[model samples]
Target: MTVMAKPRPTGQPGYSETLPRAAESAAVARRLVRTALAAWGLEDQIDDAVVVITELVSNAVDHGRLTSIRVVVSRPTEDWVRLAVVDRSMAVPLMRTDTNDDRIRGRGLLLVDRLTERWGTDRYRWGKQVWADLRCESAR
Candidate 1:
C-alpha cells in the first residue's frame, strides 16, 4: 500500500486507539500514525515511529487478519514519547536468520527489532501483544 505523508497541525500529547486487522488496516495505521504525531505536536518524528508502527500493524493485518490491533501514544513524563502497537496473535513472531533472500517477506520483525528503543511481546490466552517503544526528542 502506498502511503503519502500526511501534513497535520500541531497540538497535544497522548492518545491510544484500536483498529481491526483487515485488508484496510494499513490505511488505518497510516492515519493513526499521522494523527498521533500531529496531536502530540511531534509530526516531525512521525517517520521513524510511523515506519515502525506501520510494520507492526501490517504484520498484524497480514499474519493475524482475523484479530484486532491496538495502538498507543504517550508523552511519558515529557522528554520522549512512546509508540506502541499490539495485536491478538498467538504466533510469536520469530526472526528468521536462515534466509538471505531480501524479497522473502520475513524481514519485518528484524527491521522492527533494530529500529525501536525497546520491543517485546506479552502472551494472552487467545493471542499476544507485540509492542515497541519510540522515543521522541521534542515529546515533552
Candidate 2:
C-alpha cells in the first residue's frame, strides 16, 4: 500500500492512498482520515468523516470485489471535506431499502445518506469512484 499526503494550501488539504483490498483496509482508511484531519486542524469533523470513510471503503471491498482501492480525502473548500473511494469496479452503489429488519447487513449507504451533504459515483476508465461530501462547520 502507498499513502501520499499533500501540503495544505490556503483552502485545500488533500491526500490519497492506495491499499490492497482486505478486511483491515477500512481501519487503515479511517486512520488516514484521522491523521489528515489532525494535520489540517479539522479534528472536530473526525467522527463523521470516519463513519463516512468506513462505509465507503467497506462497500468498495465487500461489494465492488476489487483487488485494490484508492482513498482520497480532500478539503475542496474551507467548509467542505470530500472523501472518495476508488475501486476497480464500475458498478454504482445503490441505497438498499429492500433489506428486512431481521437482517444485519446492507445498510452502509443509508448511514452515508444521513451523514453526508451529497454523495455519488464517478466512472473512470479502470473502474468507479464513490465519494461523499461532509459539511464542516468548524473548518471556516
| Best candidate (score: lDDT) | 2
**Model 2 lDDT per residue over 1-140, tens place:** 88888655643547889988876999999999999888777888899999999999999988676689999998888788889999998788999987667777789999999988999999988789999998886743
The ten-residue window of minimal lDDT in model 1 covers 7-16
Query: Which residue pairs clash in candidate 2?
Result: none
- Which parts of model 2 have CA positions greater than 4 angstroms off? 1-13
Instruction: Write out the backbone clash pairs for model 1.
Output: none
User: Against the true structure, what is every candidate's RMSD?
Assistant: 8.8, 6.0
lDDT of 1 at 20: 80
Q: For candidate 1, write residues 50-95 as lDDT tens digits.
A: 6777777777777774557787666664456566666666887777
Error of 1 at 77 (Å): 3.5
* Candidate 2 accuracy as lDDT: 0.87
For candidate 1, the TM-score is 0.73
TM-score of 2: 0.86
